[model samples]
Target: MYRAHSTVATPSWFSIIAALVAVMLWSAAPLLAALAHTSSPLQLTALTLLAGALATLPLSRSVPMARLSKGWQASVWLGIPLLIFGAVSSYFVGMRLAPAAEAALITYTWPVVFVLLSQWSRLRTLRLSGVIGALIAFSGAALLLLPQALNDGLGGAANGYALALLAACCWALYSWLGQTAPVALTPLLPRLLLVACAIAAAASLLVEGSPKALSSEALLAGIALGLGPYGIAMVAWDKALRLGQASIVGSLAYGVPILAAALLVVAGMSVLDWRLPCAAILVVVGCCSAGRRDG
Candidate 1:
């Protein structure tokens, strides 16, 4: 993804709120998947992507035709389509084996990754606040995720960690490329999601044959995931990137793990503990630092 003119608009309340909306949707993902209990990861992936495609298709027309054409031209050569498929599919499969907190911590690194990639690609430079904030956020992530991983024994989650890393990398690349296209990739989000859906569906067909009949709850859960986290979250993220400073929006995402953990606890799938608040403070401080107007 060659750098385009800097795409991150000035920081704004709309961007911050949009990014926060994406975080909230993402926070619900683990809980939603647990409720769905869709038997096959691949099957679940395909279903959610299909739903995302359907949800985004109607929204595509909202963009002006001229903007859409520009975005499409910039996007076609960016490899964003592959990044989209990789990001969504890997995260779905990885969560099947990873702890909620650990998974959240790992996936949330995309912000830092995005900032670094953006800087390196000349899309944006890493500001001092971004560096300091990234370090602080990662410290918090380590605080939350390290003890848990050690206690659970990393061996059991080896595959999950690998997949999670892949997911993070893919997502960072996707977001960076989106900005590089200077948001020409946005109008194409539906198409990219649809491409991911097609690939996942084909893979599921070959590997698992056909999906098993799902419980009604599971079916509903799948739809909810598609329309919320996998679908609208992507849109919200694009809006955030378009409206906010990249580092700030990316850093704001540090809250995802905290919110996700809280959601799991409320759902009775996890326990509330001291580390949650401590990590929350660190993450919040980091987000504030990164988002400072002067930065």
Candidate 2:
């Protein structure tokens, strides 16, 4: 997705700083999500989306997100919101069964999925080398679930990782479609988030038996999650991608999961072990390999 260097300016210090800040905020998201003990993922998704909508109101005004050259306006009202609602809800749901680190690594598969989807659809041909690299990255995911699958059946134990994969795919599809965006999206963020919130809220009402009230701790964490990762991190990432060498800025994103995993380990929410680091290394290497000469 960061392959479009022509759209970005030369690297700058501010751009790098913005990228790092995105990394930090995003890395803290799961920690906050774990703390946000809602009755269901749908409720959490709605809350975070509502908070994100409020937080990005000023951003929507400051950023230029209208049609730059007008061909097709983005689906700020429907498709985009549906995708985001799916991604966020799935991620929140998946975080329950998997360790924070493992789930974090799983979502990072977005890069790999993004590369492959573009290659398959836009380019209409995927290189054998890229396919092999993608397989290797998928192997890392297998490493993550093998132990649990051994104890339970793959059907039950693999649910979390499967949902995580679904989340990654939804986000990947969103990114792929955005490559030809007729309008900028930065300014429409609030509306986008609000629409997503409505979807989540409706989903919660139907499936989860209505949205329950949040606890004080959950409320605070949800606010922080929205204002930081879902809100500011998104804005910062946009600026960084546009202002810096996109490749360099994107490389920094690979570290977000690692840092998030470390945070979980330090917090005693999870443990750092051979599985996570090795799996992460494989994922990054495979994704980088797949990116090379594929897009």
Q: Specify the highest-lDDT model's number.
A: 2
Give the top-scoring candidate (TM-score): 2
lDDT tens readout by residue for model 2, 24-83: 998898789888855478888888899888877876754344534333444545777888
Off by over 4 Å in 2: 1-6, 61-76
Residue 70 of model 2, lDDT score: 39
lDDT of 1: 0.70
Q: After superposition, how far is residue 149 of candidate 2 from its true place, in Å?
A: 2.0
**How many residue pairs clash per model?**
1, 0
Task: Give the per-residue Cα lDDT of candidate 2 at 207.
Answer: 93
CA RMSD of all predictions: 4.9, 3.0
Candidate 1: residue 30 lDDT (0-100)? 74
Q: C-alpha displacement of 228 in model 1, angstroms? A: 1.0
